[model samples]
Target: MRLFEPNTAALQALKGSNINITLDIRNQDLADLAASQDAVNSWFNTNVEPYLNDINFNFIAVGNEVIPGSLGGYVLPVMNYLQKILDDKNLHGIKVTTVLPGNALQSSYPPSSGAFTSEASSVMSGILSFLSAKGSPLMINVYPYFAYASDPKDVRLDYAQFTAKGAVVRDGSLSYYNLFDAMVDAFFAAMEKAGRGDVGVVVSESGWPSDGNGNFTTPKLAGTYNRNFVKHITSKVGTPKKPGAYIEGYIFAMFNENQKPSGVEQHWGLFYPNKQPVYPVF
Candidate 1:
């Protein structure tokens, strides 16, 4: 039951009505781009595109949280490959993107003044320009957990809980309660600093751990965080930082990954391994 049923009758029977496939290859590097692309292209062409072409099920997020790695690493070359792939395949509007870590932005405190780190400036500048030209939104993985976990004393517990005050560090005149909005505001600042302030920023991955120790990632807390986080995001109340931008954010994994290496990471799921809801999401 834990295994993914590739094409059983049950899967095919409910495919159109039940689910969508988002191909996210975060672990792949640029050097392996061609081989990976070929494999993916084959899969999509033979399996997904034909039946699901008009169904809006095809999405390719080329990379994830990779902006702070070594050179010839995640952000730069992959960005190049993403653009080329879309152009070559004529897959316009397919929503190709590379999600960056929050660290990519230097200013994240007050939410009003976020800037890309100096280390990221060289390639980030090119990326911002390219995304603007291609009309692709900047993708970011904002984990307020890391901030809290890194310095729990400094970060407010309630803010990380997604149901209370986060922190209030005003920059250029703006107040913030939670790290989520501050994260988004930082992205806006990154854009402005990059000289491409008009490009849209999208949240690729976010979530409150269902459970952890000492920090608020506990199982009981996880359920509360996920449930309220969804409500808060979907409500469109705007982040305390930016009051009017329709900041698009996507929650993290849908399933609890038992085999996912560590206990902490494996615990971050809305469902248990067998495609069952861990809690009532609806």
Candidate 2:
């Protein structure tokens, strides 16, 4: 599971379970954490140190999808500081990274042609270098829904929902049957272009909303995509580019947030705020 912030209540709720967490330090906190080592230490002590023994903290996302923006610079510095804090405490199991949206890439189609935009390249180069050195994976928010939504005329719904019967796109040797793999491979290609092919990728967020977009964001489509996503990850049939590689992923949310910006953003959750599942995910 991925938490946007270190909510003490949510942390307490996850106390004894074996759930691997991808905890995030809100984007707004990046500048503060980057400027002061003391802040980073306090943040860690307050949010992580208390539950170290009970919760399985996997990755600390310093910032979410801040790249190609002003806050981009702070991401790596905060990650470096957080990594040192963990190192000093002899807690090396948790990795430090940042989440990036698909727009980070300039060319994603054809997968082989994937390359980061000039802006993202400048930032990701350093971030990718850090990841390579730390042996940490890059967290990418892969949303095929966006790709399909933007160009539904050309991008088929079956391809995005993982229900396509066969390969829908062929990029040289890579035959992409689903948009998910194509999107992921595009990131891989971009990383390779940045000279860090060794760095792995984790799908930090990916889900179709349960409502708010007519036929595109219906509960049925959302459930189908998620259910197939779980099966695809568990099957270990990695993308065509990296066959058999284990891909760790997480759904966008657990429950609907009415407070979120209206429309599809507020409906990515698998369950309603009332706790009833919008659709059977498992």
Candidate 3:
């Protein structure tokens, strides 16, 4: 199992490959009081700043799964850490974000009624405020399979998998054939509630698994779900709610790793370990 590490040299190769990578660093101690100023200076100066060329850089993720309901206690401070790094480096163009799990929103179905968990709202309010002021977009990691895998009997396969399902039932309006758009609308609703409706929503992470580890749902379904998702994304047709804005998403992964955690996350890659294509990319 090869570990994924990012450094000055490694970052250059990654950017040269034209891969927009989002680095998750919530586990690191960037926000700690004991964190050295020199260390932070060295990091951005030595590791990040050297390679600011287009296509070589995308975003710097401050936290992962560190929302109020789960690990949010770390969010406020980590967010500050991100801000300081950006300011100290005098950097521009790179986005600083805290990649939040979808649960940060209260209800994410029907493309509306999006709210925060209450526990996360105040902190998220602060977060959205920061993103707005900083001209940075919020990052969200969503996976329909988790909701569907939890209750496959209730969730429709075609809609959840991005296949052409009869339009979904919403507010007495026959709308939404794919969950991607519906899911995005849910986030849009969340921002509206937060008074940040104008803020752009980007899928920090989203993907379907190629295997369910015998959890009842099959890998084939997950793979098909991923392929179709990319289709809708690349088609340039934005979400039903935000037709004016082109929905942007970074597919969960480029390649599968056998050493990755055993669960839905590990299998959420388009390619297998040996560089084999899981399915037709188109």
Candidate 4:
């Protein structure tokens, strides 16, 4: 389970549950948290400290996809500060990390050829170093839907949705039948190249839109993708690159945000605002 922020009500409701939670710092508040340790302490005291005993705080994501941009510089500092605070409080299990978009990679095709873009590499090195030393997984938002939608001519629908019958891409001896595994392996490959292969990855966000884009965005495709994704993760088959390794992941949205920018962005939800299932894969 994940919460975008430390919502008191949500934390209270989830208390006593066995669910491990990945709590995120709001993107807009990254500046404040980075600016002062006092701010971080106060934020934690109010939002996290009160619920620590009951809530299983597994990961505390400093920011989401804020790298390779203006907020890029703040990520590492905030992570370091947050780690110190967590250590001081004896919250060792709660890993401090940040989420990055798939675009962080300059080349991902062929999987083995994966490398972080120059823009992302400089920022990533420090963060990846920290993760490697602390034994924390890098949070990545993997969406094969976007890759397929941008180039349907080359990306097969079945492969993207994990319904492919046979291997679609052959890298070395590794046979990739699904785009999800391929995308993930690409990141692993990049991490290996960066000399931080010890760091694992936790997929922070992934989902297919149920509307707003021709046949690519439909309830059937979304259902198929999400259902097969769940099965794939639970199977523990892992990616061809790391066979049998357990993967930790979370789907994009629990409810559709009608207020998001028009089109596909508003349609990634598993449920409607009215709490109705959008074709139920859960």
- Best model number under lDDT: 2
Candidates sorted by lDDT, descending order? Answer: 2, 4, 3, 1
In candidate 3, which residue ranges exceed 4 Å CA deviation?
Answer: 1-12, 33-39, 53-55, 69-73, 84-90, 172-174, 215-219, 259-266
The residue-by-residue lDDT of candidate 3 on 1-282, one tens digit each, is 111234545565565666666655534544552255465556556556666663445577666666765456656555566568777667665676676777777787666777777887877887888788887777777777776767778877676788765776463352788776777778778878998887776677777776645643456776687778778777877777777576567777778777654654456667778988877665
Candidate 1 weakest ten by summed lDDT: 1-10
Cα deviation of 34 in candidate 4 (Å)? 1.7
Off by over 4 Å in 1: 1-15, 18-21, 34-59, 71-90, 165-167, 212-215, 259-266
Sequence-dependent TM-score of model 1 = 0.78
Tens digits of per-residue lDDT, candidate 1, 194-249, equal: 89887776676777566544445666666766676677678877665456656566
Best by TM-score: 2
- TM-scores for the candidates: 0.78, 0.97, 0.84, 0.95
Compared with the true structure, all predictions reach lDDT values of 0.63, 0.91, 0.67, 0.88
Q: Write the number of the candidate with greater TM-score, choosing between 3 and 4.
A: 4
Error of 2 at 93 (Å): 0.7
Candidate 3 vs candidate 4, lDDT winner: 4
Q: Residue by residue across 1-282, what tens digits does model 2's lDDT show?
A: 899998999999999999999899999999999998899999999999999999999999989999989999899889888988988998889999999999899999999899999999988999999999999999999988988888999999999989999999999977999999999999999999899999999999999887777777888889999999999988998899999887898998898875643563548888878899989988
Tell me the alpha-carbon RMSD of every candidate: 4.4, 1.4, 3.5, 1.7
